[model samples]
Target chain A: MEFLGSNWIVVVFMVVATFIMGFAMAGISSVVGPSRPNKAKSAPYESGIPDIKPVRPQFTARFYVIGMLFVIFDLEAAFMYPWAVNFDVLGMGGFVHMMIFVSLLLLSYVYAWKKGALEWV
Target chain B: MGDQPIWITFIVTFVIMIVLLTSMAYTTWYERKVLARFQDRIGPTRTGPAGLLQPLADAVKLMGKEDLIPEAADRKVFYFAPMITFITAILAAAVIPWGGTIELFGQSVNLYPTDLNVGALFILATGSIGVYGIILGGWSSGNRYSLLGAIRSAAQVISYELILGFSLVGIFIITGTMSLKEIMFRQHETISFGPFEIANWFVLSQPLAFVLFVIAAVAETNRAPFDLPEAESELVAGFMTEYSAMRFALYFLGEYISMIIMSLFASTLFLGGTSGPGADTYWPLGIMWLVLKAIAFLFFYIWLRATLPRFRFDQLMGLAWKVLLPLAILNIALTAFFRLIGNGQVF
Candidate 1:
């Protein structure tokens, strides 16, 4: 228990407990709630019209583009955390390196902005 | 309950969960009552005094409602997804420190459930995991509205979540660590200015980061104004269109729990968690202070919901990528620059 790493045991216990709680909350409903299912009730809700087509609909390409940019930028954030944590030890040199790293990412972000990659309806 | 062998962890976890569940339930009531006041109407008043027991009433009512699973839905995924959301949201709260370590019955125990070295990042990771519930649940529901909700959530999270990650870099630079307890402790310290002594709260030093964090945190939780994922008018409950009974409650719990957790996280980072008059001497006072600060943040969340309209998906994305992200990055650079200069490491 003295070891700092052992604290995660509490975390694991918490997660498992919370997950069970989630299940129990829903399970209670399943056991106690009414279950008279009809075709109208089972149908997927889309205003009032009944659907013949499959549920798979095409999404905009912009979501994909945004997802890609997220990967790039959040990874930048991940990389920067360590540098930020060690800011004092690394000094001016680390500062300059991080600036260069961030500026390059910003430049790409600006490129995306100018290219209208960020535009959405 | 005094000393136990290996049950300390269980006890701590139990207490934290109780606190979170109570707060989460009340947050719904708080939002409705506050929002109603904003609109000059009375909210739920018949359940209990001032509708105080409305959450309990709502929970009991939801239990009697039919558990409607769409015939075309993927049974396994829909069933599993809500658990993912609820679990991850509660798990994130495990890292939030209620106060510093203290002694009771000759045993020293930490005030929080657990203090991880990467406590802040742990919250972020859990939040990212919570999104999967919406994405998978929506896609597996076999509804077009739910699918659109899923797509919007994916896009919204990617943009807002990125800024959310970057917004904390300034705090990391200022505190020189990612452990939320240490950051809170750092802010709790007093500094001398002329003849005045004031807390070194990060909000004062990193005002820009604080502002950016508040915005991103709101968007990250998918709350009102940022709640395009569940825009009732446009998407009819969004990803939850096909959900019924307590399955819907699971998502509701997830959202409310995450809201309280984010408020706790924000109070810890910016408002000096567990810090108040005599808090250092009496540890329980610290918890009181933290709760007060978290409640203030919760009020802010409700206020925003009442005051503002939902953002267009395009505008939401543009704000994240174009405005908040750059500002967050700039905050990081500025903090690093000044931090080094303060240390006499940079001229």
Candidate 2:
């Protein structure tokens, strides 16, 4: 707990340093850079065409599905890390436990594959 | 923990921040030089002798350019987006163990900013958070190209991050630790082969994991061959299409710094970071070795950018989910099997 507290101090320092650098650069440019906003200049670029349609078009559902799958697998991977780190101490019981967990996840992966959820098209 | 004074910690953090910013500046020059050499052209030679001062010139030009925010853009998010990206990228460096502790004015000082017990997990979390910058930047721009680019980046990062996480499982299994400093110490053991003695780097025993890790890392950083998010010909600079002036520069700086951090992470994980001959006796030598290893990885990153063509979006996703992810899992399982057999505990 003491070590964690010290580490948080470093983390806070890092956050402060990053913000300072970022804002300082932005502030310098705002002071030095010229600004003249016009109808054409303020317009978002669309390859010299008069802007048509809303920018946020609906994307494919495949992306959403992939994201959901990613969340699931990511959780599985996170759980496995601590288990893997303590493999020696956990011994045979831990080994069996992880294998069962992995096998179930692998089944999900196979089912996803068979269902074409992995396909980008 | 060394229980060092807070002032020393601040000083070290300041030095690291300066060094990282300078390196990020020079990396652009390095990339241009290497890419030019690949195409048999002299790149940026006129900007102050071999273009050593090109980044300075570029920064000055950027500072003087008009800072434009689209009239239809979300004012607050547009301004805040680049800051988020830059912060996450820079913050990951806090946990990286650069070298062994050194004595300064009769006091011992560790090379890194902080020694987090959950170092690797912190890196992963920060990396994931960085995606928010791209997503917000693209969305707030109110540009079609920017939104498309953001979506692509979201998918690409998510896919590759899985492989990246799993690839390190083998190393964690072997070392029984996630703290980078502890892992480095564990790697200090020497292994002999007849006439030669070599440091027991994770790369030697877990070559497959190392290879997978590098590939995943390259994709995670969104460099060439997997740079679908920023494909210029198709998306007009992708998610960054709507950004200009300092905002664009912040994103650019973040990308390069993240590349350096990824290289440092790789070297520390697999190359017996800062552990070389005479390193234990003299700490500065360890820092040199760590820097050298990171530079090699950075060069390899540039080389790949020059050599490989960008992957199609679908192809990139397929490679990550189908090929790399499975391979990473298999690598972990293989490592476990071997470790169990070594310990005579296999059933």
Candidate 3:
């Protein structure tokens, strides 16, 4: 019991329990579940309908560009939240930390912008 | 509950575990509903009264479906992937302080399952390990799409993990503690608001960090706007392309649980978790307040899914490595400098 109350033990219990339950449930479900094989049924379905088009084709690169830009700004934006929450307690030190982080990220953003990574139609 | 601290821990943990599992089930339902709303259509209102029983029905169907492992797939690694995912998700919850301590039979037990000193670090490590499940699952699938998904997932995680670690470094520096509980207590302390006093919330002090955390967290969980790993349109359900039946469900549960864990961490770290407006006024209420706060963040996640678009893969990587990482570094330096200044010491 004392061991059970310990942090490490509790963590162990949780890890083990979740895996076991998932496995057990999965195992039980698979054991009694129906199995029927057919060529049409096995084939992949798209948008709730049978697929008639080719499997792969090249798409535009614009999505990648915008995605890169979004990710860059999105991440840069995330670091600010924690720094803002602890601003007063951190005072100058915290602000300085944030400034450095933001500035460095800002530099990358600028470079990306110059490289035409932010463009979209 | 008296003279049964161990038993109590078991019961509480079991109940919490059940709650998490059930919540994860419904989160899928929620995601579908939200996604449909975004696309402007009615989603899953057919089964069990407005689709309330949809998740349960889905579970039953998944259970009843045939289990399949491609003959070419590596049996060992393929089997282990979902297990790893499930395990890592549950590991993060260990340090979450669900509520403050409660008195039971004249003995007080902390509301959290565990209070490890390196709780934050533990979470980070667990998150790192979680990526492996995706990687291995994709690799073992022996499918090109699955392999590509795994590669993308690996790159995504690696890109974001640095920024994620950097963001937390700021929090650690400010709180001067790695323990989540300590950070929570530090929040419990207050600052003067003129003649009156106001309980310090991290949101006010660390807004930048909070925002960064939310963004990085969303990416880390591979949710919408950062869900390139499992992007259905491009990758045909990404890493789980060949996974079927309950194996698929394990991945599903792993994802939702990860989201819940992220929400809890965000609330605890930035939203003054469990430490409410008048936590000092009454101790028990502190935990209730924390739950409410965590719920708010959860809704926020759901809301983001409802409103946001998924990012391009390259864009996701660029943000993590270039933008977020640098900002996180700057954040840490700023937080350190301000703490010194606040102490009235020259640094």
* Best-matching candidate per DockQ: 2
* Candidate 3: tens digits of C-alpha lDDT, residues B205-301: 8777787888988888888778888888888888898788888888888889999889889888887787766676676688678767766777778
Score residue B51 of candidate 2 by CA lDDT: 94
> Which candidate leads the pack in TM-score?
2
Arrange candidates, best DockQ first.
2, 1, 3
Clashes of 1: 0
What overall lDDT goes with each candidate model?
A: 0.88, 0.89, 0.75
lDDT of 2 by residue, B274-347 (tens): 88888878888888888899989999999999899999988998898899888988898899988888878877
Instruction: Give the TM-scores of the predictions, in the order they appear.
Output: 0.97, 0.98, 0.80
**What's chain A's TM-score in each predicted model?**
0.92, 0.93, 0.53
lDDT (Cα, tens digit) per residue for candidate 3, span A90-118: 66555656677767767877787678664
Residue A41, candidate 2: alpha-carbon lDDT? 82
Candidate 2's C-alpha lDDT? 0.89
**lDDT tens digits by residue: candidate 1, B1-347:** 12333476578778889989988899999999988999999999998899999999999999988989999999999899999899999999888998876787887666778778788999999999998999999999999989999889878977888888888998888888888889999988999978999988888898998899899899989998899999999899899999999999999999999999999999999999988898999998899999999999999999999999899888898898888887888888888888888999875
Once fitted onto the true fold, the runs of candidate 1 whose alpha carbons sit more than 4 angstroms away are: A1-4, B1-6
Clashes in candidate 3: how many?
A: 62
